[model samples]
Target chain A: MNIPMPDFMPALPEMFLLGMTCVILLLDLFLTERSRVVTYLLAQSTLLGALLLTIMLYDNSRTLTFSDTFVLDPMGSVLKGAIYIATFFVFLYSKGYLRARNMFKGEFYILGLFGVLGMNVLVSAHSLITVYLGLELLSLSMYAMVALQRDSVVASEAAMKYFVLGAMASAMLLYGMSMLYGMTGSLDLTHINQVTAAVGSGQQVVLAFALVFIIVGVAFKLGAVPFHMWLPDVYHGAPTAVTLYLSTAPKLAAFAMMMRLLVDGLGGLHAEWQGILVLLAVASLALGNLVAIAQSNIKRMLAYSAISHIGFLLLGVLSGTAAGYAASMFYAITYVVMTLGGFGMVVLMSRAGFEADRIEDFKGLNERSPWFAFMMLILMFSMTGVPPLLGFWAKLAVIEALLGAGGLTWLAVVAVIFSVVGAFYYLRVVKTMYFDKADAGAAAIESTLELRVMLSANGLAVLALGIYPGTLMALCATALSH
Target chain B: MSFEQILFYVFSAITVLAAGMVITVRNPVHAAMFLVLTFFSSAALWMLLEAEFLAIVLVLVYVGAVMVLFLFVVMMLDLNTTLLREGFARYLPLGILVAVLIAVIMGLAVGQNHFGLAQVAAPAPHAASYSNTQQLGELLYTTYVYPFEIAAVILLVAIVAAIALTLRRRPNTKHQRVDQQVATRREDRVRLVSMTAEERK
Candidate 1:
């Protein structure tokens, strides 16, 4: 069969990023140490260009390319835009920290760009092959990024754990995909959807079995409970810069993976996966919140907080409605914004010899710089779901979505109760920053002006969005409406 | 039985028996040998399916290259097989129980058409002119080219990651710097020694 060439217009951003990444990879090798800043500039500019292309290509209609192996739709566009923005900020946040730590190498930026490309591919994935490839690309880059600080044993351990578990998860996910292919006789998600919709009753059990493995992959990627064992260790072990990137952009890829695999491809079997997600959401919410309270390290604390946030995100997903999907997208974006500022604070406070990972490191932070203290305050409050902040609206939207999905009132109540329980840790961070006396040996915030400016905007954006979330909310709803 | 049916049974029985021996063998070397047999028999089974390209690649890759490496490693290592087998007897019951459970489940599933297994029916035979390899190649190049390229990128990332994680410049190492070697004039590595030569004389 002779296949027609796919339209390059929809894949413009990805092709551009892929080509620019190659160019940047070569350019970095030729540049001197002092001129490394140019590489950073080029990387950021590449992301900006991709974002511009994605925005230009935004449309109401879905466009499939590469023999339906890739897709361009409103949801993909929105997610791409978010990933680009998050990754752009991530590069900025990491620059100072990476420079101070003597890891200001081009590889960080290159792997980061690769990771970004992976996210774009994942968001635009139209088939099982692309989904698996995109996820592996994202994961391999992250594993390398985790181990980028080659001399740190902790970083190496984290990287190893992540690599082994991530590789296994990918294998299991592939197994599930193979099973789906065997049953449906197709790899393209659209064709698979058609096949599944008309599948005989006898095959439903086998399909359900395959769905379990796929759900495991999704849960593991999302860092939901039980499968979330790697999240905290990886977060705590990695350099704050890598952690910031890990905590932000790649999440959109996971969310997109869930949306593609579950809603688009397996919508016919919603009843099978819904119960699984519900269990994952509840377990994540209960355990994540309760465990976070006993944590002293802020990175691990945020890790647990991320798990609970995944709970809310999954709640939005398991509702099995358009509104819930939109709500999940909103929650995912909100979680990214909060984490960018949260981990950004850690990066800002860290100096060459000091790692501001411990919660006690924030003692007397208010006295050190009241402005940043307020930024931290806003971030923590937003995360705790306090009113008039982004996290509150995100949680409310998800809870409303859960309630709207009939017969799920109890899950909503569980989410709210955990939110209340989760508030204590966020409050403790604030109280430590404000009430505690400045320790004589406290590390000073080693922030450059750009970081300080971006960090402030990052925090204020959360509050601003919290105050007026309608526009963003509408964007999410409209993205999924098609 | 028909000749084709006899070949299928023969290959499958050898495959399963060798796979079982691969785990049960006391010596690592024997285990490795059994693994090679398993691979060979599995290839035969693939051949029965008319997947000639896959079967040949499996034999060449796994049996030819990988199993050789495995044998080399097994021969080189000074392994304490007795120590390794110390816990095997203790765990045998639990292992057998779990294996039986899985076998039963698979047996039940395969008995029906749920798995599309050999027990239910055979796939339709292809004509002598049909070629699986050619069809697969055409589909890969034409339709699955995007994923194929992505897979290539994944390999590139793996190479980059390996270098990034493991490759380091040891400041004290005596490795030659090609740039310094080529850029060497007279003064960098030599010293004028006329007075020292007279003193030695």
Candidate 2:
């Protein structure tokens, strides 16, 4: 058989990332521990370069590459740009935390770069094998990152659970793919669509089973209800910086993937998957909100809160239209900003040798640091979907899409109720800061001026996006239009 | 029988036997090793089926990289073999039940011929120029692109999750912040002084 030569020009982002990772690795090896700043700078610069390249190469019309396994278009560009920007912030936010933990090695930056590359590949993937390759690359890198803190028992246990569960999810996805392949005699989405369209209603049941199996993988990635058992423990166990990273960029990528797979690939059978997504959405909303209220740990609470947000995001997908896809994309972008800001606040409050993870840790914070308290207030409000903030706009877009789709009023009511319930925990953080007494023995909350400035900008962006969400919404809509 | 048929049976036997040993091996390391053998033999079977690309990749990735990592971890860990054996008796009934159920399911699936195995014609000696991998590649690159991408995104999420889990804060360590390190200049952290004997006092 003749070997297919891949065209390299369309793979610019991945190639850039691969090159950058190697350069960062080399720099880390030559530089002293104190001089590891170069690695961080390199990572940020590389991400910015890739983001720029993605924008420059943005094509509204779909252009398949590598024999049709990858497609470059508006959707790919938007997702890639968002992921790159998120990774940039993730690097910035992680610098202080990694240094504090003495895990600020070169491998961190390399792995992160590779992970970004994987995400880029995933967002553009046009075939099953390419998808698996991209996914495995990302997964292997992540497993290494999770076990970076080799000495922690909790970290190890979290890693183990994540690995086992992740493997199971992957297996389910693979099995689903196999079934689809067997049924359609092709792995291409277009071919499958043709085959599925031709098949009678009787074959829909098999398709439904395959779709459900595939959705299981997506739900697990989103940390929605029933598949959410991993989130709280993983979040609470991981470093605050890592948690910040986890809660942001990857969610956007996952949403992009779900849209590409379910909405585009299996769109002909939306009736079946829509019901499943609705169930997942309602359960995620109810369980995520109800369970979060009792959590004392800030990270764990946010994890649950994230699960609930996944429910809202799923609402957008359930709409099963271009508008729904746009809303989901919009929700993902808003979530990234809010989550990063929230986790950034947690990082700022933390001092060396002391983790500011518990809800009580923020008590009396207003009295000591009014500025930080206000920032925290804005972040919490945004996360709680309070009006005039980014989170509220995200929720509105999703609900609007769901309503437009029609006949999901009960699901909408569940979402609204859970949003209200979710408000309690967000407000609880605010109350602790404003009304509760400060702990005398707590470590001083001193941070570098750079961190303070970045954190403020990050937090304020949420408010800015909330007030003028038109630009972001327009971008999301345009991205999904193709 | 033809040589090709004989070879197919040989690889098939090896694969099945290795797979069975993967479950029955008492030592966890041995079990893992058996799994590797099973993967290799199955890859050979794939080769026989004219899926050379997948067969080679299966060997390179699973047998080479994944299994090596598995073996490294299994060997490094101080596993209590005695403790493992102790649980076997207690879980024997449940394990047997599960094994039997799996066997029944497998039997039914193969017996029902739902996999279309019976419809697959015996491969001709000079098959089409387009190999299994080539067709797979064409199909994936062209049609199945969306699912492929979705899979990639799922993997990205998993990666982030793993990193987030393993990155824990330790209370006692002192490390330098990247921002602080970058902010410093030669003049700030280093001093060059020329001292005269009289001024030195």
- State the lDDT of candidate 2 residue by residue for A422-461, as single tens digits: 9999999999999999888866687767788888898888
Fnat for every candidate: 0.74, 0.02
* Candidate 1, A1-482: lDDT as tens digits: 55677677899999999999999988988999999999999999999999999999999999998989999999999999999999999999989999989999999999999999899889999999899999999999999999999889999999989989888888778878887887887888988888898887887867876787799898899999889999999999999999999999988899999999999999888888999999999999999999999999999999999999999999999999999999999999999999999999999989888898999999999999999999999999999999999999999999999999999999999999999999999999999999999899875676799999999999999999999999999999999999
CAPRI-style docking class of model 1 based on DockQ:
medium
RMSD of each: 3.7, 9.3
Q: Cα lDDT for residue A443, model 2? A: 60
The share of true interface contacts that also appear in candidate 1 amounts to 0.74
Q: After aligning candidate 1 to the native by TM-score, how far in Å is the CA of A391 from where it should be?
A: 0.6
Query: Per-residue lDDT tens digits of candidate 2, residues B131-172?
Result: 677678866654554445445545554544454545566788
DockQ values, each candidate: 0.61, 0.07
TM-score, chain A only, candidate 2, equals 0.97
List candidate 2 stretches off by more than 4 Å.
Answer: A1-7, B1-21, B29-44, B47-78, B82-114, B117-201
Give residue A107's error in model 1 in angstroms. 1.2
